[model samples]
Target: MPRIELKTEIKANKNIVFDLSRSIDLHKISTEHTNEQAIAGKTNGLIGMNESVTWRAKHFGIYQNLTSKITEFNKPNYFADEMVKGAFKEFKHEHHFAELNEGTLMTDFFIYKSPFGILGKIADKLFLKKYMTQLLTERNRIVKDFAESDKWKEILA
Candidate 1:
């Protein structure tokens, strides 16, 4: 399994940032390049604990569908989503938020086990890990953009 961790500092309220982070609509905006869309289950709005969403997207010239569910949540503080059915053997993403006087600190812990034992390990070292990191970084950038600006109201409302 490979783990990717990232921390972002956003000059926004924790609650607002939290909502933006979990917004299906915002995610669709961020991943427009990949043509990612929520096809079923909690297709829009903020996803809550135990909620699930199936996403269809084009990746590496191929279209794939992945479903993940919010397995754990604590509101503006923390949440974890695990893969229900996807390309990966298994995966879990944990989001953490801490309120600060100046802003909010958001962190993500993404761990996953790829399919195909040895091929997966080699793939991670070659390009899979970097690809996943880039995807997450881009997603987080959009989250930050919305949270730091009034644009957040477009989706959160």
Candidate 2:
């Protein structure tokens, strides 16, 4: 098991930041480089507890499909989604938000287990961890961008 934790300070309301984090549409925009798309279940808009989404994306030049469901949720505060079916042996992404005097503090706690045992550990050491980090960083950047400006209306509206 590996854990990736990131904290992002956003100059926006906590509710807005939280909404942006869970917006399915915003995810697609952030991952356009990988052509990620939600093809089934809650494909668009905000996903609530127990909702699942199946996403198709191209990674490392190979197309892959991943399905995840929101296992826990608390509006404008915390939420968690875990892998239902995907490339990884298991994965859980927890989103946290807290109000700051200046704005909002958004954080991501992503933990995952790879599939190939020792080979997977080697892959993580070699590149997979970094790759996943980059992907999460990009997603947070986009969320921060959207939450900080009126642009969020495009997706959240």
Candidate 3:
């Protein structure tokens, strides 16, 4: 499995950052590459432990529907989501938030494995890794912008 970690500082409180990060609406907004909707389990609020949601989106020019479950949830701190079914051989994403002097430190840890063995490795080495990294960077930028702006507060409220 390949793991990608990204961290960014947001000019918002840890609680606010964490809450916004967990919102499906924010997820959809941050991930412009994918069109996702929460089809189950607290579709409109903060997702909790053991909850499950199915997100239908387009990835790599293919429509994909991934069913994931919240394996861990610690409010204002950390959470983990594991893919039950998706395009990967395995996938797990852990999100962490911490309070800092300036604001909040938000981190994303993604562990994933491609389907085909040697071909997957080659694809990752050639393009997928960089693409995923860029995607994460863009997502982080959107999240940071949303969290720092008052628009996020209005949406959350």
Candidate 4:
């Protein structure tokens, strides 16, 4: 298993940042690489406790579908999503938000295991770790931009 962690400060309150981060609409807006929709469980609203959704997207030039369930959710603070079905052997993502003097500290922890035995370990060490980190950094940048701008407000409204 490989773990990747990313943190960024957003110029918004914890609740606002958390809400936006978990918003399905916001997810679509933030990533050009994904065409995702909430196919089940609170499709159009804030993802609640134990809710599940399926995301369809193109990754590594191949179409992939991932179904995830919200295993843990604490409003304005933290949440965790675990993969029920996906490409990886196992996947878990944990999101944390904390209010700070300047803004909110948003952190993401992603853990995943590749399917290929020892080859997966080698790939993770050689490339996957950095690739995951970069992807998370891009996601954080988009979220930060959206949270700090009026765009997010308009979308939410």
Candidate 5:
């Protein structure tokens, strides 16, 4: 499995940042470019432990649907989502939040393995890693933007 780690500083409280990070509506807005939408399960609001969501999105010119379940949760501190079914052979995303001197530090750990064995490894080496990292970065950027300002009030309220 390949892992991508990202850390983002948001000038906001950990609770707000944590809630915003798990908000389905915020995810939709962040991934608007990919036309990502939660098509089933908990489609909106803050997702909690043991909950599942199925998302449909256009990636690499193909429409893919991935269903993931919240496997672990610790309020305002950590959470992990694992793939129930998706394009990947395996996938797990862990989110961590810590209070900082000024605001909050949010970290994302995304680990995934592609299918088709050697072909998948080749694709990951060629572009898949970069693509996945870019997506996670963009998502964090949106979360940072919302957490630092009053925009979070809309989705989180």
Candidate 6:
């Protein structure tokens, strides 16, 4: 399994940043390059605990579908989602938020394992990890941008 962790500081309310992190619309916008879309289950708006979303997207020139369910959630504090069905053998992503004098501190903890044992390890070492990191970075960038401005209203409203 490979784990990726990232922290982002956003000049916005913790609650707002938390909500933006879980917004389906914001995710699609952030991943526009990959053409990611929520094709089923909570396709729009913010997702809550126990809700699942199935997303279809093109990555590495291959089309893939991934379904994830929110396993844990605490408003303005933390939330975690795990893969229900996807290309990976397993995956879990935890989002944490904390209030700061400047704004909010958002942290992402992601862990995943590929299908094949050794080949998967090779892939992860070669590029999969970096690719996943880029995806998360992009998502966080969008969250920070939206949370810091009025753009969040367009998605949350």
Clash count list over all predictions: 0, 0, 0, 0, 0, 0
lDDT of 3 by residue, 17-125 (tens): 8878777777777675677666655566667789877887777888888888889988889999999987878889899998887799999998889889999989888
Question: RMSD per prediction, one decimal?
Answer: 0.7, 0.6, 1.6, 1.7, 0.6, 0.7
Off by over 4 Å in 6: none
lDDT of 4 by residue, 126-145 (tens): 88889778867877887788
Name every residue pair that clashes in candidate 5.
none
Query: What lDDT does each candidate get?
Result: 0.95, 0.95, 0.83, 0.81, 0.95, 0.95
Once fitted onto the true fold, the runs of candidate 2 whose alpha carbons sit more than 4 angstroms away are none
Against the true structure, candidate 2 reaches a TM-score of: 0.98
Worst 10 residues of 2 by lDDT: 98-107
Please provide, for model 2 over 35-104, each residue's C-alpha lDDT reduced to its tens digit, 9 standing for 90 to 100: 9999999999999999999999999999999999999999989999999999999999999999887799
Which regions of candidate 3 are displaced past 4 Å? 40-42
TM-score result, candidate 4: 0.90
Cα lDDT for residue 2, candidate 4:
85
Off by over 4 Å in 4: 36-42
Model 2 Cα displacement at 145 (Å)?
0.6
RMSD of 5: 0.6
Minimum summed lDDT over a 10-residue window in model 4 is located at 36-45
lDDT of 6 by residue, 40-153 (tens): 999999999999999999998999999999999989899999999999999999999998887999999999999999999999999999999999999999999998999999
Pull out the clashing pairs in model 3. none
How well does candidate 3 score on lDDT at residue 78? Answer: 96
Superposed Cα deviation of residue 14, candidate 1 (Å): 0.1
Model 6, backbone clash pairs (residues 3+ apart or across chains), number:
0
Which of 3 and 6 is the better model by lDDT?
A: 6
